[model samples]
Target: MQDDLGFDRLLDDDGFVARLLGRTRSGRQRKPLYGPDLPVVFLVGGPGMGKGRLLGCVRHDFGRFVPTAHLDCGAPAVTERVAQRPELRSEVTEALREMALQFGKWQGTGGALPAPRLYAGLLAVATSDRRSSTESLVSEVREQDGLLPPGTFWRGVLSRAVRGYLAALGGLVATPAAVPIISAVLDELLARMSREGTAALKRCYGEYPGAGGSPELGLHTLAAHFQQGGQGRENAEKFLFRALREDIEAAHTSVTGRMTRVGRPALLLDRADNTLGRRLTRAVLEDRERGHHDRLVVLATARREDGGRFLHPPGHADEGRAATWQPADGGLPTWSRSPVGDPGLASPGRGALLVRMPLLTRDQQEREIARTQGSVGTGAGGQGLPVGPGFPGSGPSRLRVETGIRRLSGGRPLFVSRLAEATAAFRMPEEGSDWDLLDAPAGTRDEQEEHAVADVLLDDLVVRQLPEELPPEQREHWLDLLSHLSVAHDADCAQALMRERQAEREERLSAYRIAELLRDCGWPHCPRHFIGDLGLRHLLARRLYGTRAGGAAWREDHTFLRDRLAGEEEGAPDALFGTAAAHRMHHHLAADGAGNGHGAPGAEAVTNYLARTFYTRETRDWCGELLAIADVPLLGGPDDRRARALGAGGTRGGAFHRRVDKLLHVVWLCEDRARTVDDAVTSTLRLLLERLSDESEHGAEVLTRVAGEWSERAGNKQALLPCACTGHIR
Candidate 1:
């Protein structure tokens, strides 16, 4: 059986269970004088942190002593009921009927069934109520009863009957008058289960063919005919207590029966925060408190907020009081000596013992990979290599597993599972993997494999596990903000964007919308508020930059809008000049100097435009490149005819002088292509002055001093021209 259930074997390690149990027990010591009360332990963690695995461990190690019934609050039945609010009349009826049938089958077998038939019955009832098809229900029940006998059809029958009983019980509880009666019945059942053996209770609840009167009295008839005298409500209560006692005794029979008063059953509830509402949590907590008996414990798993739901309500004060194990300064408390007080017990870190589930260490991850892979093959391997071609190996290696973990899981369990699943399904190789092994492309086939894994583990399993009523908007909003934040360096900026979108009246961005976006974009929520990784940042940047509008036709039509406007404004001087300048700049930047080509005309036009507009130093950088290509002087000589014709009214000369100096400064400062600011400035200035008029002795010393000062300021060599005063002809 263990071999058939290979996955189950991995979870049967007692060490993990002991640690969990120890944490639960370390809190408040039970006082023997007052009698032992059931310990309510709540297990909490994010999705995929092993809550389910740990619960399985608990069931395996302490099933007999605890008689725990695991309930998944996120189950479809619970979620559907919470969501739609429809009365589960037929559903509940079918469930109870199924339970009764299963119970009967187990009894017929003398409780020799491999697994607990009663649990199987409960599951069947729950399954039936969930609107599962008859074939599906049968299949599920049969699957659960793997090695059980075929004639155990009575198990199905008894399971149905028990379902009916529970439905009736539910109906009775709905009424104000029968609430206490139902509560007492439940209390009695729990107590009796602790007293008598489960098999004995099954027999007492079993059908009596000749019994008459009310269905409740059928139990009395069964006891009278089968067990002789143990009947009626009082006897039923006693029988329930006896059954519970017997079950506990079977598990811990080594202990003296008299000392059993202090041993209580432990009820562990995992992910209780997923309750449809506070009402369910309160109801469960209250039931445990009212139904408290010696050695009976109720340990529930939930987020701290879920635990508070039970406490905040007025009626459940006592239940809240019982949940006194809270996280404290330094660490969790080993014992709570204080008395149970008002319902205001939930404070920050003041509810349950917070057993944090840390991320699996690298060593642990490697071991898990080795173990998982080893099961597939043979021999102790070093590690699984990364998947892909030319990964330094013919096949997968340990590095592949490590890379997969880093890429997929980011060392998170949930992520690891997701990444593993993705990598398992990943097939296509990214471009250039053969070229550069380290540069694995993201959002590629391999990346998608990683994302798909996260989708399954984190999105499907973890996020979906929340309660149905957890406001779809909130979820969407969280996902949307998370998606943006995960790729942004500034978390505050992402948050601002979310706030802005949310505040817009026309279309408020919903949480669902955000979640959908994140899913679509393959973005994951990072633990850090902002993302800092350059690779991820680049990916996000690409996504943002690559956003194109519609088809190529649409883009062409949009581009034509400007062209149409240009044709309509043919007479506009500003339009003509701007267009000409743009065309000239384009030509200058692209063309070679020969007049035979389009480049020379464009360069000449740009240089002329720069001279006419009196382009600034910054503009000169562009003009300089154009002038160089055009083979034109930026500044004319003083005695040159063009300079005389232009008029040196100090306006043109001063402007040209300022422009030349600024251009020099820019050349000196430019980082591209290696010229330092000083080098560029000196070179361009020297070239300009070489064409300067030799006769214009006006302020020659000033020009030389200016060039020298500028060069010194630029931290490069002095200009080669040595100013016009030197009389050195080019």
Candidate 2:
């Protein structure tokens, strides 16, 4: 129900459509990257990553000047409609109906959109229906009234076609049958069209399996060909989809394309990973590679990463690294060729450029905060208006909210809006400060502001988003299974846990099956990571630690994984970093409570693991691995009451145990950004540098650069302490 909140701005500045349309943010024309050939652009991200909202924004904002159409291929309404028409056997009919309507609305009277061609296809379906009569055919056309041109123009076109057809047939057509009348009307319309339009239609239809080189025959037999339902039908459907795009292109060229400026029609599809959407996209891509040319821009939202690989825009590839968003270098995202070959292509999707829909940037988050506070552009003095002081919308309060929300939401747009709205609406006590918001009680207190936000996120993003078609019992245990499995880093670990829990179920769940279910529900699937989204993973970790029957389930599960991993380490003694051993330590420390010092292997095990791998591994890779193993969410209740405690002062243990705790805190800062650097964090880095200095002459310098890198990624100012060993200060 929420509008895009200007996330559409991301798409307009040389984004998917902006690049295709050859326009900059200021509306100045630029040479299009794809030239006249439209490339399929995919917006890729995890669930709740705002793909749907971005598509909606594109349609709403861009539909004014250009012919734009949108369809949710997976929506219940669209699928239901398509299901009712088995003759079509796909969403093509439903999609074309939408496109025609949208195109008609944009062009108005005398519009050059191929309405007659679409009408011809509908007529084929109606006539092919075994239950159809002349009256039923009329009823079918009436049902599609909204998809046709204006009333006056349509009446004129139909009358002219009917009259011309009857005259050609002489007195034999005195009382024309509805079928023959409609067929003649279609033929007459096609006959009078421009040669370019006719050629496009013929080229598309000729490729149909049953067309036999006659576009006219293809038009009349489309429904019957689809009714067979096999490879032939699929091929026919492909050609038909191409024909639809061809129609759009032909219409645009004749009308918009003929003008002084060029305008391309845009098709925005949500959930384009669905079955019918895949077919449609495949048809377009295949046709393009086969040498078909058109000006119809197709932009789709995909929840899977493999739908497209992220690429930097043309000239900016050298500005920053590939496969990641660099907003500071001008945030233009696009899709590129897959790193893996065609054999490894994600099933049912390939050849399309995929750009990951980014989380809100820092600037975007601040803008949302200001908008939530009702502070528009500038004040009378040409300065920004006050965001107030001492209240929820005050500068300090907003910063606190941003820090907390960034930590909690990881900059997911929905979370940003929800938390900001909640903060703005909250009433503060006279003596209360902004810290009260961060220190709010956990979910046990349902009336607390923090609880409301957490509950909404839990239900909306996790629970309710589960595949509703799943059996009720499976749905019931899903959260518990996911919570426990969250500790798993890979499929092997996940399957180990699954086998342990098999005795509790009527049917055993494998890691593959669970992964499929999660993927179907829009969770990003990465082979190396069990749960990929940082926010969702953190939430699941919270549930694992807090929602068990005796609250001991967390330690028990960690103990189970730790013991299992220990056996693996014995089997694979040469595993780098003693991966299994390091993983075991992660679970062991979690089971014993981080920095709690009550574990079998003790702090010496962790120190040994680091000592063995720290010098051998690349610094960044080693840091990332260490962070991965240590960053378990053992903070507090669901509200994370101890969220702000990220230093050694609060950690109780021996020196090494405390160091492990501090290092985990620093790495977690990469994901859970804070308002500013705490002095304890800086001193912890300095202590780490001091330790590294003893190991090697240049080790301290390496640690300093690593700390600075973390600081940059985390947006943590003053975290890079003065290090005399490296002469580095920040």
Candidate 3:
């Protein structure tokens, strides 16, 4: 198995612990950030960027020096902590009591206890037998050298409490009339259990007794008050939050009692942007604001976007607009409020830091490539031995393999690691290296991105991410979904398309497949689809269905996705104007080599779609990017064997000749990307004008209007140049 040794460098950043402990270099720690208040550090990045892995590294590094709790917010036990129903609340209380052992198990022992691991061990023992009595169970466990160690006062108390808590938990439904009493019993039990558990653990950790936790209020008193007032009895979930914090603080007190450790215990919330995580962090902050101070450090992970919305971290908000409207007179504008300021809030992450993880740089990527290659089970760089099929017997010459791996992965760690593993399995491309580099130059940045995503990465991704168990039919389904997703404007649009198709599935996609697929492609967590992971989308789309499919098949799928999206978007006219316009126009052209519209009522909508993109001011910039990538490959280059195969068009060259003709005809109609409205209208008008000229199809007046629109603009600089001719343009 892969080990924590791999992440030592990432975890052991100098002063990282000092930042949390507020320690000086002189072994004297001073409070940092929001003074003496325990800091809440947020570890943030985009999805699939390995936040969870970093959390694991943190636990590994600090497991010896300090106690920590790793809470998976998505887990049912954690999330149900807020449930209001009586039975659910009982279950929650029982879970928390069992969970308290995570920190409590260090009781009477002079050592550190990482919360999750301790509790997981205790749970294994406690759950090993539901049939045995409390004494018998604890005794049996002790006899077997289970997690619940014998000969300790707190362990004995904890064993009894666990028995009672479990009994009370199971009796909630059977004793329906006593639910309020049972609920109160559970809460009081949790409060006492967590408190005593921490108290027993409060001795000799790292230089001092940590958090000194005791029953501030007795279980009997709490139970009496809850019974008399009927307050805490109403919702057993109330104590869950209080108990969670108490346990952590208790653990801290236990570790640092009497002597000043000058440091706080830590709580690591995995997936902190999720339901339980967000609520827990906010609750703690709110408690602090309400003058309920506690000495516990918190570290959580979130997506980059949520780092601001929920946690209010600095540098997360827009600092300033690159294109701000300021007065030209060299004086401050009438506006007084700071753009990023929060009223009455000096700092949003008051005592915290939001550390954003960046992707691997080129040099780092090269090192990682070298490491992966060298570790491929046989000292992969050994001399005079071929690494795999087609490899040079003396190796591919140092850095050749590294360069190839880096180019394929773009330095994203997951991709780099995944591709590296695949290479180890076999150095030859699994799908076969049909991909060729774009040797020709392109004018725009988009083409370079296209080449990287489509030409460089897609095939490798397919071979890596797709599961071996994936059936052929399902593979085709996934391909169809991916290709259509290429044109999606946002997550919502993509989701809608997926949902519509999902309804037709006879069997559901497996969760593992869904997760892997989602990881393979990034959604619109940024500025819609353009700012999304376009490289992945484009590459997957081109490889799966774009270049591989024949003419008829390509046309069929594109047309279907286009019409389905159009129909799905029929209700929201105002919302569908700009983004949908580009999709509509492109898909319409894919199926036909005709004008913008083909005379049906639906054709008018297609014409309006193109018109909307061409004319709208706000959409014009977006339209240009869309049009820049828009391509129609009618025939291959002069050197292309496929083009040569289609010799003498309009003759009996069969499928090859017909496919070539169809592509050319489509290009003849669409013209080129019109930079301005007047220029854009000519795209449609050119087709109409030509149609009219050929047979006076829409009358001379139709030709006249199209001709007038063309002249009004600068006239087409390059003709699309289509013909039913045999010889080439020469």
Give the best candidate by lDDT. Answer: 2
Instruction: Kindly list the per-residue Cα lDDT of model 1 for residues 341-447, writing each as its tens digit.
Output: 54334321223333334445455555454343332211235443443432223244433344435433434455444343333323324211111211232233344
Residues 418-516 of candidate 3: C-alpha lDDT, one tens digit per residue: 444334323332212212221111123354452332333344444333433455667756655665555454455566555655677875554335434
Name the Cα RMSD for model 3: 14.2
TM-score (all chains, Cα) for each model? 0.41, 0.71, 0.51
lDDT of 1 at 650: 20
C-alpha lDDT score of every prediction, in listed order: 0.34, 0.57, 0.41
Per-residue CA lDDT of candidate 2, range 15-58, in tens? 54566666543555555655554567777776667888877766
Clashes of each: 84, 1, 15
Return the TM-score for candidate 1, rounded to 2 decimals.
0.41
TM-score for candidate 3, residues paired by index: 0.51
Candidate 2 residue pairs that clash = 335-354
Model 1 stretches astray by more than 4 angstroms = 1-35, 60-66, 79-270, 276-299, 303-333, 340-351, 372-410, 421-458, 461-470, 473-478, 487-495, 499-730
Worst 10 residues of 2 by lDDT: 721-730
| Global Cα lDDT for candidate 1 | 0.34
